[model samples]
Target: MTDVIVGAALVRAGKLLAQQRAWPERHAGQWELPGGRVEPGESEEDALARECREELDVAVSVGGRVGADVPLGPAKVLRIYAAGLVSPGDEPRAVEHSAVRWLGLDDLDDLDWLPADRVLLPAVRTLLAGSFSSLSTAQDGL
Candidate 1:
């Protein structure tokens, strides 16, 4: 089985959490969904939760995956899952990066996103759209 790189498409109030890279000059300043590689003995969910805690210092609940698995290398693939903050009062920070930004669908295209992360933008857009698509039905007046 190939190793998987997991990411969290954490959206709240119509915005998705994006973490900016601060290391490895090559990728510095690029944004990516918060996550990392799944360890040998860890399940995808566990890995995501662990990554979030380690990288963002916040807990999250993983939901259905956002996009199809993307090839990272011959033996590794990148996968992302929809997620929400477990502690609503707690905000994610750039524990390992330079910054964290919450972006709405309209602003998605403007970021200098990490190569792998940019691939999931379409799916992320779809997810964010659906998240706040609720419309009230008031046929009979209140």
Candidate 2:
């Protein structure tokens, strides 16, 4: 069976949270979403929440799946899910990453993303676009 690695596409206030890798020389300095391998017997959502807490020092509320599964290698697959900070005002610090940034739509393509993460850009774009559209509609009504 293929191992599952979950990624959190955590968005807030029209921005998506991205983290820069700090190690594994080949991938260091490249950006990717916050997440890690799902432990055996743990649900994807649970693993995502745990990863967020461990990697970002913040709690996240996992939402729906964001994109299709991406192959990592012969034995591992990547899955991304929509998520948001449990406390909207909470700031995510780079606990294990080199740095963390909140990226706007225009900034997404500028970063050098890890190969697996690059595949999900379109889905992430749609997620952020939907967020902005909803915010715009709500503001218009107000």
Candidate 3:
């Protein structure tokens, strides 16, 4: 099975970073979270970091796993994770994305996402819920 690494970067008060692919890229012109396949010999975390850097020119701080291993189509195992920007100023340079936006979780439904991500949405939602558990806990403290 094809092993793919996907990142969910949270930024700016809960907005999640999303990207529109550039032409010639897989799922070109569609919006999805930024990440790519794990290169041979690279760990998933390292591959994620490399993919983000190569595709967006922005550095990211890898975070906890928000998604479970998922099968996409007939031969793909997608590993999605929750991540954050290394710094708030690290806007995407979009090397492979034609456009990039920081989206709120509620807004994710509006985008035309890549097929793998589309199939992975239920898990993404559950993952985001897990990620937000901390926020809810903090808010309860407030």
**What TM-score, computed on C-alpha atoms, does each candidate reach?**
0.92, 0.98, 0.79
The digit string of per-residue lDDT tens for model 3 on 50-138 reads 88888888778787776567676566677777777788676777787788887667988999887767766776666566557766788
Q: What is the lDDT of candidate 1?
A: 0.90
> For all the candidates, what are their Cα RMSDs to the real structure?
2.7, 0.7, 2.8
The best candidate by TM-score is 2
lDDT of 3 at 107: 81
Residue 92 of candidate 1: its Cα lDDT? 93
Counted clashes in each candidate structure: 0, 0, 0
What is the overall TM-score of model 2 with all chains considered together?
A: 0.98
Residue-level error in angstroms, candidate 3, position 101: 0.8
Candidate 1: count the clashes.
Answer: 0
lDDT of 2 by residue, 1-142 (tens): 8999999999998899999999999999999999999999999999999999999999999999998999999999999999999999899999999999999999999999999999999999999999989888999999
**lDDT value, candidate 2, whole model:** 0.97
Looking at candidate 3, what is the lDDT of residue 60? 82
Candidate 3's C-alpha runs over 4 A off are: 9-12, 126-142
